[model samples]
Target chain A: MINSISKVINDVGLHARPAAEFVKLASGFQASIKVRNLTSASAWVDAKSIISILMLGVSKDHEVELMADGLDEELAITTLRNLIESNFK
Target chain B: MHYTLVDLLKSEHIMMAVQAADAKAAIELLTAALVESGYAEPEFSVDVWKRELAFPTGLPTQPVAIAIPHADPDHVNNSAVCIGVLATPVEFGQMGTDGSIKLLVNIVFLLAIKEREKQVAMIQQLITLIQSPALLAGLISAKDKNQVLDLIQQTLNEEHK
Candidate 1:
């Protein structure tokens, strides 16, 4: 099953530390999580990879889509959205 | 395993007057250079560019603006560096703990080896180079490819010794 959540990056852009933190959180899930910019189709990336996420160039107020598929898709989506909402707090 | 930035850049990989009118274009040009150098496939550029859109790599410099072009190591086929100097500045995300950034003129592209263990030293060296203002300015003022390469070599030499 495919589950998804969307959130805007409010704490500025996803730089090194936050990207690292986001990857760490995503890596905990059994599902395959991917993140992308909602405004652009070309922004999709592996959510569990810090380098991949850092390459996305996401800026403040940029909306992103988090999609996951696997055994724990719902939990992955919820956790990812929460992270994005909290600006990776 | 360890190569100088100039050693990483081949003549075939060098593109002068890259038609980079914007950030996306700059990325495309840099990625294309990587492919032409045999460091990656043609599709690699688009794949990395897509990833870049989700996570920006603009680094805010103490003296000036700079950007680091990076992607998942798996997206690259070989290890190398590709650089593009925008004739006109473009906005990059930011660096380190803080995300504040403005217009940046220089971009240092990184195509890392697939395994992290294989690139530890190179990555450390590059990061150190990034944080050095003297080296950064020297690179920015470099007039040509040879000068740029020399600057990188000089910095690397200082770092190693």
Candidate 2:
């Protein structure tokens, strides 16, 4: 299954702490999740990797697409989308 | 596998004065340069930037400023290093704490490694280099890539011995 959601980076940027937090959150679910820039047609990267997310150069106003495939795909997508939408607040 | 900093850095890794206005531009330019040097795949740079944004790599120093650009091993297509010297200092999120950093960051060590374990020695060597005030000054003041490479080699060699 495939689901897509877009959100602007609300925080200053995803820097280390936020990145680590995002990874920790993503790692909890067994489903495979990948995030990518909506403007860039690159393969989705492992959502749980801090390094992978940082390389995307996502800044404020940059839109990202999160994709997931697995048994709990819906829950994973919704949760991640909410996380991004709320800017991890 | 054993690799020297010289082996990790290629001709393309050497960029003079990057004309980026902000962090995003800086990251894009640096990543493209790494790809050109064959140090990493084209996609690898973007991966690194994305990861960096998520987890800022700026490490605060006592006498000078430095940042180590590293990303998940899965995003790396090869084992290599890229260096960047910004024309103007940019804000890098503080390492190990919640703060903002705006130092004249003259050095950026972009590491693209295939295996996380293999990076231990290199990381140790880098930590040593950072702790040395004299060496750090020499690195920041080095005029060219040759000088930078030589300094790195000397420092690493000294650490090994």
Compute the interface RMSD for each candidate structure. Answer: 8.9, 11.6
Using Cα atoms, each model's DockQ against the true complex is 0.05, 0.03
lDDT of 1: 0.65
Model 1 per-residue lDDT tens digits across residues B21-95: 667778877887777666887777777666556555666664566666566665677777676656667766553
- Give all candidates' CA lDDT scores: 0.65, 0.66
What is candidate 2's lDDT per residue for A1-89, written digit by digit as tens? 77685766676555445555666677777787888866555445567655556545566777788878798888888887787778878
Q: What is the C-alpha local distance difference test score of candidate 2?
A: 0.66
The estimated TM-scores of all candidates read: 0.61, 0.60
Q: Interface RMSD, candidate 1?
A: 8.9
lDDT of 1 by residue, A1-89 (tens): 66564656666566545665677788789987888766555445677765556556666777777878899999888887887788666
True contacts kept of each: 0.00, 0.00
Which ranges of candidate 1 are over 4 A from the true structure? A1-89, B1-19, B95-103
Cα RMSDs of all predictions?
9.2, 11.9
